[model samples]
Target: MGTTVETGPFGHLAEDLADLQLPTTDAEEWRYSRVADIDPTRFARAPVEPALESISTARATIDDLLGASTQPPSATVVVVDGSVSAAEAADPVRIDVHAVQTVQTEQASPNAFALLNERLCSAQVTVTVDAQARVVAPIVVASVVTTDGVVVAPRMRIELGANSEATLVEVHRSTGPSDSLVVPVTEVEVGRDATLRHVLIQDVSVRSDVVGSVTARVEASGTYDTWIAAIGGRYARTRVDCQLLGRGADARLVSLYAGGGDQMRDLRTFQDHLARDTTSELVFKGAVDGRAHAVYTGLIRIHPDARGANAEQSNRIMTLSDDAWAESVPNLEIENNDVRCAHASTVGPVDADQRFYLETRGVPTEVAERLIVAGFFDEVLDRCPVPGIAEAIRPTLAELMSGDRT
Candidate 1:
């Protein structure tokens, strides 16, 4: 694929990448996270067919190793080897289901993989939720990046019509120990009075490296809720940027991430209020162990005309091991004094007092520690709008705390 420069409201990819390069140890965001260990030159582009059964079977081999339950079976579009499956699109919104490759890259801030995706991304699955329609089923989009020494760029575009409502669940999966690189980009447009709820789960294996970004536009009176969860990956970073374009728009952002055994995950979020009466809130929680590191950075901007805007952001981190590290930074750039904005963050280990209290109550130190960790994550889980998901995080957290490698 050849790269052609394009301009739009979001900005050009090449323009953004002019001075920006793929992250390295020198990069502020990559300081704690190192990527050189994964020899990028050894990666190959993934194949068309992923041998789903074979990989699924391999994953099952670990059933006895892990106590956490497997993801619930549901209607999903599994993208393997950089291509989406052609199976019928079930419970989709307004867009067609068939898998088609990329056309022209959209106008947006570009990065290292931007040019590659403009050319190599194999298929595009478009999904749109019509105006005023409320969709109940969660649209599940899963991707497996397994190519060795190759890079894959996947793009997903979602459009929500005026007054429409929908929920999207995107999952990232990896098979085996193959080295892989993936750059997935998502663009969302929320029409006037529309509400879009997005839940992104990055449950990749230990061998994959991922860099993803989501850009969203909310029109007048629209609402957007985004929840991101990342459990595993070699090197991972997720960027969420949203703009309230019309007056009276609202947004809610929540995220959870856990890193262990040399893995690293970084989250960068941006909330821009450009119109009057816009409101937004964000809450992010993270945990790190076994020399792993995590970072959470959030920015809330209120433009000059965004009077009466109310925005709040909070990030909290729990470090489980002495070798692990985590950081949180919440920033507010307010140009409108009439708006109400506040931001705060906290990063540290579990409360020893609480642990000692639990231990004094006859609980073993290990069990007590697990309980403390569980309680730390419960804050976010309890707020999960999905019924079963919140209840499911406990056991997962338990397995991780239990020191199981699975």
Candidate 2:
């Protein structure tokens, strides 16, 4: 049933490939997902390319992807076609680019896509912050895909030392409208008393597909905050897992996504509390237009030792067209009676009362609806830790709302 291989650098590629089995829609984790539509055999692994020669060229590429209005980052790492093309950093930050032939297959991956990513990833990039160092500017990582009918996997790890403070921005973009698959995985470790703010922006071509994963662990008295904006891709999905492993850990998760035309946006999250007095809160909001679809499923679990833990999860969706569809499911599993957990989810159209109030104040019906949608997203956008991301996302949201509103 399975083949086993020795563990080493670039070992067991053939055996791993032989045992890889793609997930199906029947699986609980894959339920309501478009996993069946994906044919991994259709795409080939990305070809190796030489790193960019000039720092100026790398900076220009980053600016082009992030937009001109974004502030200058303290450090920048650019990955193209799963390889580290360029890396630049300022003080108090260390950037390491490792060229690896293959991923260590000792541990099994969460899913087939993740396993494929592990096997095909071209390089591993790590960013480290020194202890107690407070960085004022954000560190930017730009992962770009530039080929068609090819698969690209990018792996990144961020480590924060004890009592350190930093902000990071990770973005995914395509150079052109290519029908490709991109799988990216990110790992984060927050040391004791450290604070980290992470902002993820996915704006790939609508012709491509993306499946990404993020995993983070917070230590005692540490805080981790993340904000995600998913605006592009034909079929885009992201799964985030955050664990509070030490007492007094805190986490805040916020996301905003918009889908239009025939696109599909899927998001899943898990908040795990394993220690006493830990807390976590999540808020996700999305809107669908035309025949687009959106799905969000989140779970908050508290372990028996997680006494006095408080966790909350919420997901809300708005449908702007009759043909659009949305699904929101929030769940909680608590083992300790002393812990407090609550979950809420809603899927519907614009609020009638809010629309009526706006129209009664002389705003046109169309303008009232647009305003309502804008106001609905602003609640989550306002919480974004990055400065220019929210500004750049507003135009996209506006364009989506400008479409036929039912």
Candidate 3:
């Protein structure tokens, strides 16, 4: 591999640990999140782990990890202990999945976790779809960290050429003692008139913590949509940035997260429109029960030169216990005229009126609250980019709601 292990801006930033050090609540981004729970220095100062030959000594199939799906995947890739262990591509002619030594450099950003991933990541996954070729089967990528006290950083890139179409599903899971950490970065590029559907599901052990981010750039007439489902982890966080850089480009982001016990679910998103006639929409919802916590912040930015851009964003979170807490912030930054933009956000408990109505109709209070929580999530679940994700998570959500309201 000709790739420079740590020669880019990331390496430089990694050396300067000033702002990248463990953040405090004084920082705006770490306000709602439990900054005290994460000890960045512990993971950052550990010895750099070498690339793994295999992530796990014992491997499990996709179905065993994530239940059966209505749409069987056409291609599959597995990354364990931070290494790409197995890869299968149904049609190698059009879809190229391989490992390379070199990667193009990226612009500098304030995302500390992203820079950390670049600085330490030894495993990289790349996918390229040939121009004008449509892949009907979906692609599945599963990543796992099965060791204790090990920090895993994985990097990935997905490229779709003009007129090509495909779907990708990313699954992240972990087993073993919860004294582990994972930070993943995925960059996506959609070419002219191409279409890409992406979904991410994170279900690590509740004792583990994960911080990840994704960035996507869409070209002229391209359509890129994404959905995320986050359920388990001690402190799980994900950030997304989607840029519409060409005319007629369209992108949508829909996400869901649920937390129970002492877990934390943190998510942030940005939709940037850089061209005229481009459109973007985002919807995110979540629930926190027991002593759990959840946070969401989203922003839509329309550049001055981006005339006729349309943007919409919505975020809501529900708290099921008195000790459970949630925070939501949705904002819009517009520099263009004659453009459409809107944002809405809310954080609260189950509607009292709705609950009262259900109780009057002979429904138990606990059951009524469960139904309301289920309904709150269905709005976004039904609009997910993929078809089978909602069904696969239904049982999990139901169990979470019915098991322990406290």
Question: Which 10 successive residues of model 2 have the least lDDT summed?
Answer: 1-10
TM-score of each: 0.84, 0.90, 0.87
Which sequence of candidate numbers ranks them by TM-score, best first? 2, 3, 1
Residue-wise C-alpha lDDT for candidate 2, range 1-406, written one tens digit per residue: 1111212233223444666787888998889788888766677666566235433443455576456445678888877767677788866888877643333332224677777777777777788999899988899998877767777788888889999999999988776677888888888889999999999988777888888888888999899999999887888999888989999999999999988888889999989898999999999999998889999989898999999999999999999889999999888889999988888899999898998998899999888988889899999989988776787788878876565211
Model 3 TM-score relative to the real fold: 0.87
Candidate 2 displacement at residue 374 in angstroms = 1.0
How many angstroms is residue 81 displaced in model 1 relative to the true structure, after the best TM-score fit?
2.3
lDDT of 3 by residue, 1-406 (tens): 1122222222222344455656677888777876577655454322233234334431463465444566667777777756566666745313333343334435325666776676566657777777897887778888777666656776778889898998888888765544677888888899999999988888777778888988889999999899888886788999888889999899999888998888889998889898999999888889998888898988799989789999999888999999999988887899998799988898999999999999999999998998999999998788765666788787767765554422
Using lDDT as the yardstick, the better of models 1 and 2 is: 2
Candidates in order have lDDT scores of 0.69, 0.82, 0.76
Write one digit per residue (lDDT tens) for candidate 1, span 220-292. 9999898877775667888898889899999998888887777788888889999999989898888887787
In candidate 2, how many Å is residue 276 off?
A: 0.7
Candidate of highest lDDT? 2
Candidate 2 wrongly placed segments (more than 4 Å): 1-19, 50-61, 64-70, 99-109, 403-406
